[model samples]
Target: MKISELFYSIQGEGKRAGMPSFFIRTNYCNLRCMFKSGNLCDTSYTSWHPDDDKNLGETSIESISDKYREFLCKDIVITGGEPTMYADELLLLCKKLKKVNKDSFITIETNGTFIGEFINYTDLISLSPKLKSSVPFDTPQKKMHDKSRINLKVLRKYNSLYKAGKLNIQWKFVFTSGEDIKEIKSLQSEIRFKNENVFLMPEGVSEKDLKKTRPETVKACLENNYNYTDRLHILIWGNKRGV
Candidate 1:
């Protein structure tokens, strides 16, 4: 299988924040996000950019399992370039890891596009749906705004996973300039989930970008009674990957 990078790190986001964990970033993605422009996407030092050829690495399920066994961390994070882009291989890998450590917790950090195939194996699903302001509708080559963004099919799949109780799912909205927080609140209302399960993470790649979101955002979350998540990895490593 095509793997991007595998290493041990602390859980930087979501409910499992601060926990020591292992990260397995897979190669390829269903969506073509613009990373070079530094507009919407979070560019990692080790290259989390979906289309970067230099970031590509090769590994088998057995090797990955061996790495997990070596680290022996209870929490394992399977992240992307849309990790679910290769669901069959991931499922096999996760199953193998479970056999090695039955109590291991598996989390999938996804763009919420391909939940249909991976929901069963994942213990937690961090659903970070891209807001319009973050994803400009433009191709990387054209260097012009395109306005294209994540689809509703992805949203529905997340809802389905929540309803099925297959995994603990949380809605993470990445906010940037011109984003409509009220609209996101409305969407949350429509979904009918308690505010505790919804989170707002400032759209950022580095500590500087993360601090761009005013401290007041946390107050806004409290006023709205929603959860606030910080990008701990970025805070600690400043956009570095493979931590």
Candidate 2:
């Protein structure tokens, strides 16, 4: 599969926040989220607007699994610029991981734009469906990103996976302000997400930026009974890659 950096880092967001994990960050993305904090998406190194391509390559599942095992961690994160774009490769990687370590905890960080059957092997679907705050106006990429960002039909399929104990899931939205609270409410009304599964994360790539956005995001989570997570990696390591 086409790949980016692979490293051992603490899980920084969603339900698995702050846990020891191995990350296989795939190269490339389907959407370019212009975060409300005025920062480009933090994973841009693996993106179309790539900053450093040192980690870019095509490697086998054997190599990936061996590196993940080398870390000796129970948790593994299959992340991306958009990992679902590599559905077949991801499927094979998951199969290899499961065969090697049946008790492995796996998380797939995604924009919720594309999903494939291999996801059934995941332990948590860390689905961050892009909020309107991510949308940029008057751009072709915007239209493509907007169209690909949400699908209730696809979400329902994931809900079924959750219900059948195939995996856990979280509706993790990057919260920019109170307006996003209203949008999250509207989305929940459609999907009927359990309040417990809803997570609100402050938008930013640096500690300073996260500080500025936390208050509004915190208020939204408190008032709505949703879970809140800090971006532990950003707080600890700034925006540096290969954490």
Candidate 3:
């Protein structure tokens, strides 16, 4: 797999938040997420500036699984710039992880733009479909990002699998403002995902900014009956890599 970094850390958001987990952060993203407030994606090194001193060029699946075994962790999170971009490699990696320890839970975080073989094996699908708030300003990637961010077909399929018990999925949105809530409502109506499976996390990488946004985010979650998740890693460790 083409990897950026692999380490052990607690899941920072979503349903599995606070769980100590092994992380496999993939390299390259199909989108460049820049919020209107000028905040870039938390892991922009894996996305917008992917090659800036962090690329761990293509490692073998065996090597990855071996590292996980060394970590002695129960949960493995395959996050990304966008994991599905390397679809076949990701599927192979997940298969190796399962083979090593079938009981170990695997979570794949994605932008919800693509579906892959890894879908069948992942225990949790952390789907963060980019909202209008994620669109970057005055950049060449803006057009591509806006055009490819939301894929209803993929979202509907995830919803179907979740309802049928074939998949465990959660819709995680980066809550920025009331506009985000409006978009989430419209999306939920279209995708018909379980309201209880929806999670709204305030969009920020720093404790101060996250603290500033939490109340409004919590308020929105309360009104919509959606679950509110905090960026536990940021709050606990500040904004830095490798936990």
Best-matching candidate per TM-score: 3
TM per candidate comes to 0.85, 0.94, 0.97
- Per-residue lDDT tens digits for candidate 3, residues 1-243, read 788888999998998998999999888899999987799999998888877465786888888888898986889999988999998888888888988999889999998998987888899999999999999999999999999999999889888888999999988999999999888889988988778988999989899999899999999999989999999999999889888
Clash totals for all candidate models:
6, 0, 0
Better of 1 and 3 by lDDT: 3
Model 1 shows how many backbone clashes?
6
Question: Candidate 3: TM-score?
Answer: 0.97
Which one wins by lDDT: 1 or 2? 2
Candidate structures ordered by TM-score, highest first: 3, 2, 1
lDDT of each: 0.71, 0.84, 0.90
Q: 1-243 in candidate 2: lDDT tens per residue?
A: 888889998999887888899999998888877865567788877764764448758888998888877876899998888998988888889889998799998888887767797887888888888888887665668888777778778777777777777768888889887778888788778877789998899889889989988888888888999999889999999999888
Candidate 3, residue 122: Cα displacement in angstroms equals 1.2
lDDT head-to-head 2 vs 3, winner: 3
**Candidate 1 per-residue C-alpha lDDT over 145-185 given as tens digits, one digit per residue, 9 for 90 to 100:** 22324546667667766787755888777755333477676
Query: Candidate 2 — number of clashing residue pairs?
Result: 0
